[model samples]
Target: MAGRRRSGGWRALLCLPLAGAFSLTALSGCGPVPAPDDPEGRDGRAVQRMLDQRAAAVRERDADAFLATVDRGSAGYLAEQRRVFRQMSAVPLRSWTYRLVRTGGFEPARVGGRSLAAQVELRYRLKGYDTAPVVSAQYLTLARRGGQWYVASDDGVVDGKRGTEQLWDQGTVDVVRGAHSLVLGVGQDRRVLRAVADTADRAVPVLGHVWPQEWAGRVVVEVPASLGRMAALLGASADGYRGIAAVTTGEVGGAGDETPADRVIVNPEAYQVLGDFGRRVVITHETAHVATRTATSASTPLWLSEGFADWVGYRTPGRTPRQIAPSSPTPSPPGTCPPRSRATPTSASAATPTASPAPMNRAGSPAA
Candidate 1:
C-alpha cells in the first residue's frame, strides 16, 4: 500500500501489482532469436512466437486471429474465451498490449508430458475511460498441436491468486465525453449521466481560471452506482469510506509536467442527496485537487488544502455565514472591545484572526 500514502493533498489507496515468479522489466521490442537444433530451445522459440501472435491479435482486435492462438482441444476453455471476447467487444478500447515477461521451463500437462507454461503481464486501456494502462500478471499454459504451439490455459493461477478484473468485467458502463472531460457511469440513468456531464462542463473553465495551467485542464470523473463499487475502484474498504462525498486518486510522482492517471471518484449515495449548489461545491473541490495534484505533496496540511478548495467553491455563491446562520442572534458590540489578555503580536494565537466559520452539517462536520 505504499502508493496509498496521503502525501499528495488527497487520500490515496493503491492496489498491489499482481506478483509472479519472473523478474519485472519495462515492455520493449526484441529482435528474433536464431533457431536452435535442441528440442528445449526449439520449444521456447515456438512459445515466444505464439505469444507474439496473441499480442498482435489483441492490438488488431482480430477475433479470429486471437482465437487461433488458443488451444482448440480444450472445448470448455475455448467457449469461456469466446464469452470474454464478446464482453470486450462491447467496450471501445483505446489500446491493448501484452508483453512476455518470462518463459518458464517446459513442464508436464494434464493431457501428457509435452506441454509448457509461462507467466506474462498484460496492460491495456479503454477509450474515454482509463487515463493510464492497467497492468495484470497472467499465467499461460501452452501445448504443441499440429506442429504449432497454442495457448492451452490463459489464466492459470499463480500462488493461488488471480489478477484483478478489468473495468469492463465489473459491469456495463456508459461513457460520455465532453470537450474537456470524460464521465463514466453504470446503470441506465441517462438523465443523471447528463447532469454529471453538465456539471463537468461548467467546472472546467472555472478550474482553468482558478488554477495554474501546468495541467492539461482535462478531467475524468467516475460515478459508480454504489459506494461499494466506488470503494472497489479506489482500492479501499467500504466501511472506511463512510460519509465521504468524493476523492481524488492516482500516481503521485513522475516528471511533474504531464498529468498522471488521476481521477475524481464520486460517492454515489452521498452525491445523489446533494442539490445543485452542493453538487457544484463537491465537484469543484475535487477538481481543484486534480489541478494541483503535481504540486501538492505529503507535507501539505490537509486543513490548508481543503480550506483553499472550500474557499474557491463558496466564493462565487454570494452566500455569507451570517445569512446561513439565521437562527443565531445578531450581537451589536462597540467598534473597539476591551482586550482580554496582553498577547504579543508575534504569538501564534495573536497572528491569526478569528473569522466567521464555514457552514457545517448537522453532525458538526464541514461539508465538502
Candidate 2:
C-alpha cells in the first residue's frame, strides 16, 4: 500500500482515486500514425500492458509513481488523483470490471514517446449489495515514457446515478436493534445478516463475548439496503470530503442545544468500491459509532475513532487495510462540522430498546 506514510497526524486511511478511462482527453497536435509494419492487435496489447503496470502500482497503493505515470498537473488534480487510488485500494477485485468500449486517437510523438486514447466502461459490480452497479464511462490517455507506455489521464468519469429505495426493496434485514424498535423486512441472501440475527435471536450471551459490552443495545445493525437513498445523495459532499459515506449530526455531549448522539448516513455507491470484507467492515465501522455513548470526541482522536472502527469492523474475520496510509500530523475536520468549544458529558443515558425507528428506517424509502 501507501508505504508507511500517513496523512498529517491522523491514522485514518487516506483514500485515493482510481484512474477512469472517460476522464482523459487527448488535445490537438496530431502525431503521425505508426508504421504499417505495426501489428493490428499491438495497440490493444500495448494498452493492456500499461494497464497491468498501473494496476500493480495501485495494488501497492503507490500514489507517487501512479500519478507520475498519468502526467497529473497542479496540486488539486494530484490530490484528487491520490484520493481515487485510496478508494480503489479498498475495492475487491471481483467487484471491479474494466471493458474497452472504443479505441482511436492513435498517434506518435506523444509525451513519453507515443500516445493513444481509448474509451472504456468501468462497471463496479455490487456484490451482496442491493444497490445499483456504480458504472463510469472513462476516457484513458496513454503515453510511452522511457520506452514504457504509461497511463496519463482519465477524463469525464461519472459515478452511476441511481436511487436508494431501489436498493432496500431488493434485500431484507432480519433484525433491527435500535433505541426505538426492531424492523423485519423481506428478501433473500440470508447469510451474514441472518447469522447476526440468529446470534441475537438465541440470546446466547454472545454479544459481550463477541463485541464490547458497551455495544449491547447501543449497536444498530442494518442490512445492505437500509439507507441506500440517503447514502447516494450524500456520498459526495459539497465540501472537500469527496466520497463521504455519511455525515455525523449533533455533538458528543448534550449541551447548548446539543443532542445526545450523532446521526450517521452512508452512500450506497461507496459500497461498490469495497473489495474483500469492505462492505461488512465499513458497515461495522459505522455501526460502532452508533454503539458509542458519545458522538466523536477530541479525547478519542481521529485515529482511534476511525482506526478502531475499522479494527472492529474487520473483526469478523480475514480483513485488513491493503496498505497503511502515511500518517498526517494535522487532523481533518469531521465532515462539514464547524469548530466549537468541547462540551462535557452530563451522564450516560439509559438506552431504550424498541421497534424499528420510523425516522431512521423508512420502509421502501427512495434516495432523496
Candidate 3:
C-alpha cells in the first residue's frame, strides 16, 4: 500500500512555498562587547545570532540563507534542525515569547573550529490551532566563530525535557479493540495509541520475510500514536544503532521479556498509510518483515526487504497487486515472491529511501 510521505524535517521544509521564496543575505552579529573579543563568548553570540537569523529566515521563509548557516555534515544535527523546521512550516508562527535561560557547560565543536559548544535554555511561547499555548524551554548549543555566533544545534528541549513529536493531522482514525474516542487534548493521546496498535495488528501479515508466523506467539508489537511523536522516538533510537531501522511511536525501553523469536516492534508511522485507508495494507507489509526477522545486515538487501513487505501488504482484501515498476531493480530474482496482484495507485505515496528510516534506542535496539 502506498502512503503519503510526511515532509522530511529540514530538507522538506526547505522546499515549502513560504520557506522556499524568501532570500536572507544579511548576516547577524554584534559589535565588540569587550576587549580581545572572547572566542568562547563570541562563539556563543555567533551561535545565537545564527539561531535568531535562521528563525527569521524560517519565519520569512528564506531558503538560501537557512541552508547556508547549517552544517549538514552531522546527520543528527541535520535531522534535528529539519524536524523543527518541518513543524514550523506546518504550523505558522502566531507569536513568540523569548526569555533568557542558562548554559550548563561549554566546549568546542568539531564541525567548525571557531564554534564553541554551550547548552543554553530558552523559554518561549508557541501558539497554534487545536494545540494550547505551548510554554517551552528549548535547549541549544551556541558556537563562536571569528567574531560572530552560530547555533550548533537546537535540541527542542521544553521544560527541561525534549519536546514531543508535533503531529499535523489525525483523520478518520480507527481502533480495533478499545472504544477509542478522539478528543482534542490529553485524551487524544490514548486514542492515538489504540488506533496505532490496531494499525500494527493489521500490518503484521504484510511484512512476511521479517515476520513469519513462527514467532507470532512470542513477539510483542508496539506503535507510535502520532507522526510527530515518531521524531522523538526516532531521536532516542538513533542515539544507538545504525542503518535501516524503523522508528514507530510509543514509550522507550524494552519489553524485556521477549526473545528474538517472539518480539517484533512496529513503526507507528506505518499507520500514516491508514490516512488513505491503505494503512492496514501497509502495516501488514511492515509486520510481515518483523515476523520474518528481516533487519539491518548486508545479508538482507533493501530492495528485497521493501519488495517483500510490499508483496505481503498487497495480499489484504480489496487490494490488486501489480508488478514492480520496471524502473526499480528487483531485490531478488523476479520469481522469488508471488507476482504482484494489486493495482498500483494512480500516484504512489511511498516514503523515499533516505538514510535508514528506523532508529534504534540507546540499548542498541529497534523499538521491538
Clashes of each: 1, 53, 50
Predicted candidate 2 versus true structure: per-residue lDDT over 1-368, tens digit per residue = 12322322122222112123223212321223333223234566666555555555655557776776564323454565666665445333334445555455332223444566665554443223212233444566656556655556554232343211212323322343423212223332445344434432332222234445443242223334423344433333233223433333223433322332223333333433444334444444555554443444546676666555555554553322322111212334778655453653221110001121111111111122
Maximum-TM-score candidate: 1
* CA error at residue 100 for candidate 3, angstroms: 5.0
What local lDDT does model 1 show for residue 240?
61
Q: Candidate 3 lDDT, tens digit per residue, 1-368?
A: 01212322333454443443344211212122321223244333544566666656665656666665566555677656555454345333444333324344333346555444444432222222112222333445444455555556654343345432333222222222322111121113555655645555445434433353443311133333433434443344432323222422222222222122222233443433234344444445445544444233335565775566565655545432222233233356765875574654221323322122322111122322
Q: By the TM-score metric, which is better: model 2 or model 3?
A: 3
The C-alpha local distance difference test score for the whole of candidate 2 amounts to 0.39
lDDT of 1 by residue, 53-88 (tens): 887787777889989988888787787676666555
After superposition, candidate 3 runs with Cα above 4 Å error: 1-47, 72-88, 96-100, 104-109, 122-133, 154-368
TM-score of each: 0.60, 0.30, 0.32
- In order, the Cα lDDT scores of the candidates are 0.60, 0.39, 0.39
